[model samples]
Target chain A: MALRGRDIVSIRDLSTEEITEILDHARSMIPVAEGKKSSSALEGKVVATAFFEPSTRTRLSFEAAVQRLGGRCLTIADIGVTSMRKGESLYDTVRMLSSYSDAIVLRHPNEGAARLAADASDRPVINAGDGSNQHPTQALLDLMAMHETFGTLAGLKVVLLGDLKYGRTVHSLAIALAQFGSELVLSAPRALALPEDLRGELESLGAKISDEPELRRAVRDADVLYVTRIQKERFPDEGEYRSVAGSYRVDASVLDGAKPQLIVLHPLPRAGEVDPEVDRTPHAAYFRQAFLAVPVRMALLSSILAPTRGG
Target chain B: MVRELRITPIRNGTVIDHIANGLALDVLRIIGVRDLDKDSTVSIALHVRSGKIGWKDIVKVENMELSPRKVNAIALISPSATISIIRDHQVREKRAVDLPEHVTGVVRCPNINCISNQGEPIESDFRVVRRRPVVLRCAYCDRQVTDFLRHLA
Candidate 1:
């Protein structure tokens, strides 16, 4: 199917077949991104990334993806440094950015901000991250990583660790994971546990979900460990982040009794959660996970820009 | 049908039947119908046992046309409510009620910190995002307004 000029605001918008198509396209683009092959599909297309919030992986991965596809990127990293600080609304910023680029990737601290921007912009608006709401692209990339590691999601045992309450990535990923029959182990501090209604929804979708207090018990026999940082910025109080930060940490010693092929993943910007010593171990697939984002995003961009016939 | 037959007939007025008991006042409040005189025949039957549904209430207002807004408010209060609009001893309309898409100036967001709840004279606006579970997100605050604790305008 073609993906030209489509706004990827939520993973809920993609069916299982479309997600598989994106993964397939991403897998095909891996060789080209590694310099094994050459393709200039997005030659003259200009992609604009508007980050109103703090980001490193998402921004850089998008930039890399656009560049790898032979396209240019116009990035705005800080909202304060831009005209937004001088009394500009998000709608105005989107309208102005849309005129300059073929597609706009927006990351904002407000919930439903992407939808508002999408409504305003003539160009396609992809939601990079919205305030504790969704990060569709991250979910897509995580699915790609999981598919590459586990072969299929039919009966995979996946554990999502840390800050489920505030982590937009996990929320989006969990929603997407529900489409596939994946048993989930949600490990989080009591204060940062996943919302009850969402958990119920997942359970309704035939996902065998269990909440565990400790990270070790959650990841001991799990096929995948998806770790997220305790987002301090999302909390209105600093004490909340402080209280829940130490309870969930994955290190070399923690994985001593775990499965040999256990894939540990973290949506980066680590703050003493996962020990650096674990980076050398074959279990640490977070870096590869981060690198995997490029090709996935490339496929996403290509699908959005130059879709196949009858797509 | 037996529950409807239990309620006494009104000559020329609206009958809001099949409302859940103890919710009639809330329904009245939501529809902004508080100025009825004490002498006026405003009959309210509450906690009346009914077959199948266990218990329900019926309110018969004397000489009043049940507005669409009032019907919608009744629907929000009790989803299974039936509104019978009467005119000159004739049943004009009798059917199930439903709230409109853009419900303005009624049912304030319960969040105290919400802009609509700050007494700024702003209309309490909501769009029905999800119909099955009846999820209403505030137009101003974007907070999910559930059924249990909605503030009437």
Candidate 2:
């Protein structure tokens, strides 16, 4: 269960206790994150960031996490400049990256790219995001935020709204929350409903699930409403994307019937999923959700890079 | 004690009996019958009724003993198929094929952008997650595969 030298390819690879351990470490890193104090957990360690896909938030959070931990980082983005454009396979790139760093953080358009990288590399592989399959680190930070709000991850009435099918964060968070015994409410159009096999699996895990197509109806009794953007990039048809574009907007008016203590979280870079006016509400925790990524990621980097005593 | 057989039994080979009624040809494709030796005798019976499954198909291959990989593929397409290995006109080892926990190289991950599908040197591997619906999760992409016929590797 020790995260040291492990590949974080999926949230399923982590146990509930291991997840909580990382969160606890992240909480302790909050002071270091705010520059109130500093930790040299990765003073001499090197971490590599090889993002094959375009990103703003995830890449920045990882680079900042490495820097905060006093580790040297080498970033190579394949979106513009890399051998990946020259038809170099993920294995080749990952093999090369492993030679240069103690740990590698990877993001690819392919769903299982991190697993591929981890299988080939001796160094620890951290998945930033992989297609629409999983984002374990994101789920960890999201849980940390949930733990901050509710003081525990168990038994919260969690409503996951927006594009359930294509949102990687939604998939990982839903499964991880199920492992924590959260009551799950899924609200999405039929086109984007939770995959049935996954739903069946979650139900078998003793997590109660309810189908609520209307976002307002879904969040009325929610303790935590985790929203995700309906990614236009995932849909091939423009008209189909247009049809579901504004289907689940969360404004102050929409939250009128919601529980007063209900906290709303979103993996940011929202494309009109939440109203700007709602950003001023007490329920808006997306910004703090984003801020928590720094310390959480710092904890992850430190865990993987820190050397054990007796060496 | 026996009379003349309707179809002559093979001396040695595999007899796959009670295949789900219309999937004989599909099973042939999976086992690569076209690539078998020219001298081998292969017989297929379709729309056959049986006391067990009521409607079934049977395939008999002379001079070919199917590997575990082929048998595993048979389990996916026809969960109730029984593989009977005949030696010297006697049923030597007869057992019903059951799906293994992990199956590899049987079918491809349907996700087009899956790492297993990107011309990599990765053989498709699936973890048999559910049996009733025959759900398979790609070992690489975590994509659930239900349409097995479409994504046969």
Candidate 3:
């Protein structure tokens, strides 16, 4: 029941019970975050945000979460602007940051950067986002959103649209969703489809997964349309991103044939993927979803940094 | 008498048999054994035609206990390899090589960008997620490694 000082690098490390516990805690913190109630569970703790890559939502959410818990935040927003630009290795950077904080939240461009940082640091390291590998906190917030919206995650028809291969959020979400017995519809371009082995593993977990190139047919009867941007940054060639960028846009027109109660979710910073017009509709939960990050992350941070009952 | 292709018997050492043809060198590389010492005798036979399974390679190492870790490396490189552990000129243990839970300090990640490949004093750790399909997921990066690369280490 105690998760204090734990490094949250991946959802794979969390058991179903622990995940549910975190969700329960997140639910409790939601009212506090919306200014209906207040609790300073993480009162004297300090969180360090060490972002080696560019991030606005993830970084700020962690800061807001820490402040909401009556804790302070130390941020190194740009690695290029820090001592790292002067040739400090990631290990040294983490070692230095660990000395100043209780927990370190890392967003790095390398796949295993967070793990490496955790190994080097004295404090717990939370992976905010790691290069197309994992974003565990994002997965947590996503599950929290689903639970809040539908009241249950079991047996939901979720369709993940756009760039499965390069989308870190979807990758982590898919792994988390597998535990809930959710059927998945993956719609992406052939070049951007989920990896063959990930698909096989999900199938083994009894997730009814089907890949479709066309977005329209895939989202026709979906309960949740989880949209992700086609990350141009991950493409090896700029021309490849250019070729596939416009294929899976979810505009206002695209949702005409969608399920009546379809909740459209996007882990945003959108680039022409979800049209601006769709933001006014009832289906648009993306902004509210983004705002939910604060409470969910606060719950996560509090649980991770709180004192142990046995001790 | 079937005209036997002669192999000098190792006096008191392990013999790894049933290695897929052309993978003996790869197995050797994974085990970090490029050249055998003068005191430690090693014999390798490659591309030997086998009646049961087309062609195979065999490696014999004298005065050494073939660790399960080494056997795992052999499994990664050559899935069909059978390990025979010899003690006092007798086969003590013999079995088909199976993947290990965590293969540390052996069989480096094939990904060029992997931290293990960068000579960072980090051991390459792989968890055997699936045995039948022979998939090893890297502990650090979560990269699925199917093929063993010689140049990685």
lDDT of 1 by residue, A1-311 (tens): 45678888878778888999999999999997787888898889999999989889999999988998899999999887888788777777788999999999999876667766777789988999887777999999998888999889777889999899878899889988888888899888889889775686678777888887777787788999898988889887888777876776788988988899999888888898899999999999999889898999999988888845763
Chain A only: TM-score of every candidate?
0.96, 0.97, 0.97
Per-residue CA lDDT of model 2 for B1-153, tens digit only, reads: 886565678999999999999999988888788878899888999998799999999999998898888898889988999999999999999999999999999998888889999987678889999897688999898888888887787
Best by TM-score: 2
lDDT of 2 by residue, A147-173 (tens): 998899899999999899888998899
Off by over 4 Å in 1: A81-83, A307-311, B1-15, B33-55, B58-73, B86-89, B99-145, B151-153
What would the C-alpha RMSD of candidate 3 be, to one decimal place?
Answer: 3.1
TM-score ranking of the models: 2, 3, 1
List all candidate RMSDs to the true structure. 4.8, 2.2, 3.1
Best-performing candidate as measured by DockQ: 2
Clashes of 3: 0
Question: For residues B1-153, could you state the per-residue lDDT of candidate 3 as single tens digits?
Answer: 897756777767778888889888776665555445559877899998888679999888877766666676777777788888887777888888876677776667665545555444467777887777677887877888776554233
Better of 1 and 3 by DockQ: 3
Evaluated on CA atoms against the true complex, candidate 1 attains a DockQ of: 0.15
- Tens-digit lDDT track for model 3 on A1-311? 46888999987878778888998988888887887787888888899998878898999988988887889999998776898777777778889999999999999877777777788888999999888888999988888888888998889989999999989899889988987888899998888989776787788878888776677888898889999999988887899988898887888888999887888999989988899999988899888889889988988899889877764
Candidate 1's fnat?
0.00
When summed lDDT is taken over every stretch of 10 residues in candidate 3 chain A, the lowest stretch is A84-93
Query: What's the C-alpha lDDT at position B65 in model 1?
Result: 72
lDDT of residue A160 for candidate 2 = 92
